[model samples]
Target: MKSDRPSHEDFPHFQTLNTRWMDNDLYGHINNVTYYAYFDTVVNRYLIDAGGLDIHSGPVIAYVVSSGCDYFRSAAYPQVLEIGLRVTKLGNSSVTYSLGVFAQGEEALLACGQFVHVFVDRARETPVPIPATLRAALEPLCAPG
Candidate 1:
């Protein structure tokens, strides 16, 4: 059977993360739940660094309304993970991010996932248009459906 997992070339942005011993489960691999953390980390780190997202005081904020992951292989503790990210859908108030998880120096994905974030007013908690700066940063990552 052919593998459907994406490759590192599929993503425009990348972040390197180290797995902590605590991330391992009794089964001896990184727990399924930890993959979500990697998803969130890469996304937020991009927003903060490139998009000027002020997590603490920005008037606009992004909230993860939906997310999911598919595992093709397991990763153990002490492994270096290279997270690849791309924007698949960019809407006025929401953005869908496609992510791939790979072991360092590898080209194939160990896992793949997508996360949808809805931009909203920090105080009102109501959906708002994606901020200009953030949208600009995300444009380069947008992929045609």
Candidate 2:
């Protein structure tokens, strides 16, 4: 049966991560909170790699202002996970990402979420327009309206 949920084709970018034994909970599946960690890892990894983000000494920084996830299936340790990502909304200083988690080699979504990041002046912690380079990097990832 085809799922109405989002799929790998919906996203333009992909990042892969491996699950660790430590990620599992007593029930033997990945802990619920760990999904959020996967969300953060993929988003920031993209920012740093494609957006030219300077996590250490950049004038601008991104803060996680909002995020939420929905799980479709349980994933446990020993599975390689793939994150499919796209920008659902791109604003002056903030971006909303639609991220999907899938067991590697699987087409179905194991989980999906929207994660928000607001660019800010590193020192003042006030919102600032996303830098041209970073914004350019993000444009390709934005889903068409």
Per-model C-alpha lDDT, please? 0.94, 0.93
Q: Every model's Cα RMSD, please?
A: 1.4, 1.4
**TM-scores, one per candidate:** 0.96, 0.96
Report the C-alpha lDDT of model 1 over 1-145, residue by residue, as the tens digit. Answer: 7556667887989999999999999999999999999999999999999999999998999999999999988999999999999999999999999999999999878999999999999999999999999999999998756
Measured with C-alpha atoms, the lDDT of residue 89 in candidate 1 is 96
Residue 128 C-alpha lDDT in model 2: 100
Candidate 2, 1-145: lDDT as tens digits: 9676888999999999999999999999999899899988998999899989999999999999998999899999999999999999999999999999999999888999998999999999999999998999999999989
Lowest lDDT sum, 10 consecutive residues, model 1, at 1-10
In model 2, which regions exceed 4 Å deviation? 1-4
